[model samples]
Target: MKVSIITVVYNGAEHIRDCIESVLSQTYPDIEYIIIDGKSTDGTVAIVQAYGTKIARFVSEPDKGLYDAMNKGISMATGEVIGLLNADDFYRHDRVITNMVSLIEQTGSDAVYGDMLYVDRDDTQKLKRYWRSGWYSDNAFKWGWMPGHLSFFAKRTLYETCGLFRLDMKSAADYELLLRFIHKHKAKLSYMNEVTIVMRAGGISNSSLKNRLRANREDKLAWELNGLQPYFFTLWLKPLRKIRQYISKPPVKNAHS
Candidate 1:
């Protein structure tokens, strides 16, 4: 099946090449790579332009925000399945997409997600955290468990059915969307059991204590928006879950291995 990988970037010239190259290097033959840039003025557009048509769809324009650009990319995507890769992250290996497609076909699942690693921004080889996403359960969201968004891939029809990311949310939009799809809508999910993406450590939500608190508030709102109630400890457990990831180490063989 053809997969569409979307990368939304803004003023990310320093690492956009790595993100783009990772998609270009995928072992899977049928991939439609789409990049939505937020009118980057820092030469990010030039770097992506250097690749020419290798990138199937490139849009560089001012957007509302991160999730807005992502919504635009999703609208443009035309493939059996779609996945989002951030500008500061890259696929774990050339065959990550291959594995995702294989598992989706095998399990006949609406979505598939695997593990992820958090490495230093300057030195990706230096592992900082290992997010091993275990199997999904019916009450996973109630316990604040979620698969890595970067490693998650879902059928295009799922998006057509459930809807796209909310523009109002600042940080927890991804969590909200996943909660809606997997928990509320009951989308059939499959676990890939491997690291699918290597992400840079500094993310918006975790960059500051204030931002984290804001994200916590938004996370609570995520459940309320869906007309669902999270356990009292749910939002607390969400950030607390990452504490274990920081101490966890990657296995000998992962997607890159």
Candidate 2:
């Protein structure tokens, strides 16, 4: 099945090349690489153009924000499955997508996700922490168990039915989207228990104390938006959920590498 990997960026010239290369070098040949850039002043657009025909669709223009850019990419995606790879993150290996697609087909899941590493920006291999996404459970959402956004992939039809990211949600649009998918629609999501992507630390949500607080507020808002329970209490769940990252170990070297 064809999978569309979308990368959303704004003035991300520094890491855009590596991100595009990671998608292009995937062993899965059926991937459609789509990029949505927010009219970067840097050379991000030029770097993407170097790939030219290899990119199924590339657009550079002003956007509302990250979620808006992602929404635009989703609108242009034609593949059966869709995934997001932020400009600062990259696939773990060339075979990562190949294996993820296989697992999705084998398990007959509507969505699938794997583990990921939080690595230093300059030292990709020196993982700062492991994001171990345990297997899915019906009650997992209540406890804030979500796969890393960078590693999650869902069927395009799912997006069509559930709707795209909410531009109003400044930081937690992804959290809200996951809640709708797993809780409201009850999508069959599978956890592969293997690393699928590597993300550099310092994303907008956690970039600063103020942003982190904003993320917490947005997450609480997500709980209410999806018609879930205890919206206010959900704020405490965030810190507890993050503790798993430092405590889990990586998968076997041969299996993951």
Candidate 3:
């Protein structure tokens, strides 16, 4: 099946090259790679442009915000599966997409996601933390369990059905989207233990304590908006889950396949 991967970037010149190279090197043959840039003045566009015609779609216009740009990419995707990769992140290996697509298709799952590593921004090889996502259950959200958004891949039709990420949310739109899909709509989902994406240390949602609190509010609202109730401690446990990731050792190089 054809898979469309999108990178939503803004002023990411330092990391865009590695992101582009990782996607371009994918062993999966039928892949459509797109970059949705936010009119960066920092020459990030130039680095993406350097790739020339290899990119299927390149949009370098201003958008409302990060999720807005992501929605744009989602609307443009026409492949059977759609995924997002930020400029500061790269796949674990060239066969990452190949393995994910195979598992997702074999199980007839609407979405698939797995583990990821948090690596240093300057040195991608230096691992900071291991985000090993366990299997999903019907009540996984009750315990504040969620798959890494960067590693999440879903069928294009699921977006058409469940709708795109909510723009109203500041940081927790991804969690809300997953809550709607897996918890509300009950999309068939899969979890492979392979370390999929390696992301840099910082991100918008966790940039500050204030941002994290804002994300907490949004996550609480996520369940309420879906007309579902979360456990009283759900929001608290969500952040607590990451503590173990920091304690575990990083996976072996070939553990994925």
lDDT of 2 at 32: 93
Return the top candidate by lDDT: 1
lDDT of each: 0.92, 0.85, 0.90
2 against 3, candidate with superior TM-score? 3
After superposing candidate 2 on the true structure, give the runs of residues whose Cα lies further than 4 Å from its correct spot: 205-213, 231-233, 255-257
Q: Say which prediction, candidate 2 or candidate 3, comes out ahead on lDDT.
A: 3
TM-score of each: 0.96, 0.93, 0.96
**Candidate 3 segments exceeding 4 Å error:** 205-211, 255-257
lDDT of 2 by residue, 130-238 (tens): 9888788886777667778878999999999999998878778888998889878999888877788888887664646786788878888887887777544556676
Order by lDDT, highest first: 1, 3, 2
What TM-score number comes out for model 1? 0.96
Q: 1 or 2: which has the higher lDDT?
A: 1
lDDT of 2 at 246: 77
Please give the range of 10 consecutive residues that has the lowest summed lDDT in model 1.
Answer: 248-257
Predict model 1's lDDT versus the native.
Answer: 0.92
